[model samples]
Target: MLKTWQRCTSCCLGNKHKGDFMHIYAIGDLHLSGEPPTKPMEIFGEHWRGHKEKIRQHWLETVKADDTVIICGDISWAMSLEEAAQDLDWLAQLPGRKLLLRGNHDYWWTSLAKMQKRFGEHFEFLQNGCIMVDNIAVCGTRGWLLPSAEAFSAEDEKIYRREAIRLELSLQAAAKQKPAAIIAAFHYPPLFARTEHTAFTNLLHNYGVQHCLYGHLHGENHISAFEGLREGIRYKLVSCDTQGFQLYKII
Candidate 1:
């Protein structure tokens, strides 16, 4: 076990010698619409007006080709791969290496193989997977609400367990990469509320993951979103609107 961990540590340290140090950024819930059927986000609230432009400007000003960005999901408003390509086209022009996870509203997200074939390498999709940059490993899944949630049902519980398993798969993948640190991203907040503990949080503890980034909640729902340190892990809500449409610097 120690030898395996050491190998990972060495791999992480070795990655830093590639010229310049890497900068990592994370944000979520982009909710971008595509093509002629563009869906206006302003309907959700005043904050979403021109959200795409806001994200573009912020990304241009903040990230570089050498930097890494994690989009925690709800990326596009498209209903199929064909439409999603337009959004992907715009995202490809942006600077930095990007890892995009899925959100509830991401109907266009299809098979990873199909997406890779279509977008090439413009971005990586995180579904029961992970990515590493220098010493930081990013792992994520579309988390689900716990059984304790007010609206939790038998069906919700079933999906919740599946999501938890996916989260574990992602974390395990990151662990094998042997990163010095782990940052977990989720489309849904891990916990139903700040004070509530769940299987997702337990997994973070088991894996020694130090930070968690998430989105999905918006407007008044932000009040229940978890933030700050809990059980040795730091949680951050990176919803674009919540973070003022700016990328949250993770390192």
Candidate 2:
């Protein structure tokens, strides 16, 4: 049986009353390629054929204006802000308040100020900040490559530490909100090895974060994904491809 929205939310947060207040959904790795210059994801895999349409159909069916969608990252394939406009516009037309986090492939995300100026409240960026809706606090930052990744290097370690600090900052902001629960979103996996905890997971554990949403990993990489309960945190992978182009209802 398909899980009801209310049931899922209540299960994740352990609060039936707060879950009734709002519906929260999450999906990432949109990779929306609009117009001619943008490269469609179909070029990489047969699974991506008509993916955008599938996403639109499922999203319109599952989400509502009052709900919130946490887009875990890789939202667009545009090379520049100008090129990303069409893709961004399409996202704005979708239901609910879209909270955007940065993915590794998001090259057009050079400036938060410019993005805010362009789309206004239609899209909310989740870098170094957190937003509260109903009794849930949403927080996150662009995560970095794990040490287990083949491309990991000394330079990558610098970024890894930096991203950890940024995650801390975002979590701190969420803590300040005093929400009933904190749902941390990430563009990168918190742990490379599912069984081993990393600095990112440790911080979340320290802050009492019980639910974490992330993307980036796909295909065979899914085997390494850390899901279910671990050390009091529930981690879930919400990449669009992994979720079958449907929104993963978080609340």
Candidate 3:
């Protein structure tokens, strides 16, 4: 475990799941280690601060200690582990066993095994990992954006393919649970900006993954105004930094 400004979290084992009919809360990109910036809303004239209290209140009330929460990535913007600990303490105060994924800005994150050794008693820090939660299979990857075929450079294709492979591998591991449902999580949208049928999305479709959650875009950069929900399946946007960490209830 490491120390930061406010609290502490030992990186724990991930891909360990159990039960059925879980009240899963999906949120990511909180960047929650410091006092939040309120001026962004004032300068940009956006609704940035609109949902902060709402999300926190709703989560504390909705989540029992047994429930599971997925912090999809970018939990902190702290530059080092010591700086991050204070922030993690804030996360620690929240209820539920957590499944933490990586985000591009997570500078303090080390290897998954190290995380497990550190926080094994508490939260789960996952990377290309899977778990079972109450009869549901959960797998996750911090996917990278691939260049589209229209703009596909060979290097971009190679990197995208690698990340895609990692995603599939994680899903395959999670499939071992033979769950009643499957929810895949990522830091970046498996699909591209405003285009739903990207390669990663198609791969997930082929696997028949029933639900998906991701984040990485803000209001200014948002390409899809609509959340990814359709036909009894869920395509959720879980960027907590922007959404004030609103909990996504999977009933």
CA-lDDT, candidates in order: 0.84, 0.84, 0.68
Give candidate 2 regions above 4 Å deviation.
1-21
- By the lDDT metric, which is better: model 1 or model 3? 1
Using TM-score, give the best candidate's number. 1
- List, residue by residue over 106-198, the lDDT tens digit for candidate 2: 999978889889887698899898888766889898888887778899999999999999989988887776666778999999886667767
Error of 2 at 103 (Å): 0.5
Task: Count clashing residue pairs per candidate.
Answer: 0, 0, 19
lDDT of 3 by residue, 109-147 (tens): 887777677666778766676877756667888887656
Answer with 2 or 3, whichever has the higher lDDT.
2
lDDT of 1 by residue, 1-251 (tens): 11222234334545665535567889999888874437898888888888888989999998989889999999998899897888889989999999989999999999999988988678888888888776678899998877777799999999999999998898888878777888899999988566787989888888888889999989889987779988778899999999889999987
What C-alpha lDDT does candidate 3 achieve relative to the native structure? Answer: 0.68
Q: Which residue ranges in model 1 land beyond 4 Å of their true spot?
A: 1-19, 35-37
1 or 2, greater by TM-score: 1
